[model samples]
Target: MTVVVNENRNKRARVASATHVAGCRMDLNVRDFAPMAADEPALAGGTDEGPSPLEYVTAGLAACQLVTVTKIADAMGLDYTGLRVDAEADVKFRAAQGAMSPIPRFSAARLVVRMRSPEPPERLARLEELVEERCPVSNLFLDAGIAPEVVWAIETTG
Candidate 1:
């Protein structure tokens, strides 16, 4: 099916995802896109075809942060050679499994951005501030009462 996107329509973006499940493993299909497999580990009775759902959430947070920082840096005239974001979350599964009430998504999360840049610490600090405010994924968690601890580590070079 050819989807005709109306340019005059609302600017909001939308994506559709469908999943085929068997046991603890499933293949996700996105519209006109490559299929991705997801599964739990052996302990959870899965073949581990790909990362678990929570893992994908963590990865998306990191990717969104990186992209936000990059765009902000470009606009702020900050020069950088390389950038990387390390992300981790305190994920608790018992809640989702009905074993625990008041299901917690992630108790906490941390994002550390490592960069090789010629810019000074102050500029990077400003960039970090903007990213925290602007990154949609990070804000999604924050608004849900899971404010992630953010860190900026830069190796300055000329």
Candidate 2:
């Protein structure tokens, strides 16, 4: 189904390959992150900050999906700027009835996609639909369970 789009501008999300050793404590890889630009420093801390690897994983789900939404708006010719996903999470043990696990059992992230576009609700909803269709990362978590499965692609090797 071809949705008519005026103004051929586009927005897309890109990622590089990564690796994380299954149970090794030290060698872990992360693919999703905004680089520490000159504007933002790496260290602004008390004991609470500097996201653990799990936090990065959770955040990636939200940010990657929101980028998908942004691309949807762009393709549909919705004049917009400044899209953001404000996400929050809580981690807890799934079956620990009474034990307080010092380590988090699993983390949760609630995504609040902040969008600034001048489109009606129906159109916006359609845009979201298109985004969901196009976003592999979002679909991976939403439709299928988040199990790791690497696929082979015959594209340019980077």
Candidate 3:
């Protein structure tokens, strides 16, 4: 796979393109993946065809965390039968609504990671720490002054 590097030395360049599809709706494509739609809610004059941009951002963070956790677990030889992640974010739309506000678009976010594993508590704690430290999307939230609350719930397995 080809990698593009931006001025930020530690970051890799990722590109996505969007096409406007009527009021508050857009068709977006990333890499070679299937096309996806992004739309605002009906209240925001959209058709509500797909998730809003903010929703996509929140889901991206959750997906990133899950990917990071799975990679780390495999590297650590941690065995798990199942894994799930639930994510939510608090958003302030004043800026998006054409108002100048000091508050950020995403005020905060929460993540609940549930895993069924035979690993010990210490091991699970270590996994959580590493995920928090390594997940790039999570770091993005932090860099934007939004500290995400991450909870790890591990169910011990035989």
* Residue 42 in model 3: lDDT: 94
Minimum summed lDDT over a 10-residue window in model 1 is located at 95-104
Residue 89 lDDT, candidate 2, scale 0-100: 53
- What lDDT score is found at residue 4 in candidate 3? 35
Q: If both were scored by TM-score, which would come out higher, candidate 2 or candidate 3? A: 3
**Model 2 pairs whose backbones collide:** none
Per-residue accuracy of model 3 over 1-158 as CA lDDT, tens digit each: 11233467667678999999899899999999998999988977799999999899999999999998998888788899779888999977554445543444788899999989988888888888888888999999999898899988888988
Model 3: per-residue Cα lDDT at residue 68: 87
* List of clashing residue pairs for candidate 3: none
| TM-score order of candidates, top first | 3, 1, 2
C-alpha-based local distance difference test score of model 3:
0.86
After best superposition, candidate 2 residue 50: deviation in angstroms? 3.1
Per-residue CA lDDT of model 1 for 1-158, tens digit only, reads: 12233687757766867476887788777677788888877766787878987888899999999998888888888899779999999977443545544443687999999999987778878887788888989999999899999988889898
What ranges in model 2 sit over 4 Å off? 1-49, 94-108, 143-158
lDDT of 3 at 5: 36
Q: Supply the TM-score for candidate 1.
A: 0.83
Task: Put down candidate 2 lDDT per residue, 1-158, tens digits, no spaces.
Answer: 35554554455444443343222222333266643211111332123224555566567766776777766676667765566666455656455446652445444345566656656667766766576566655555555444322121111111
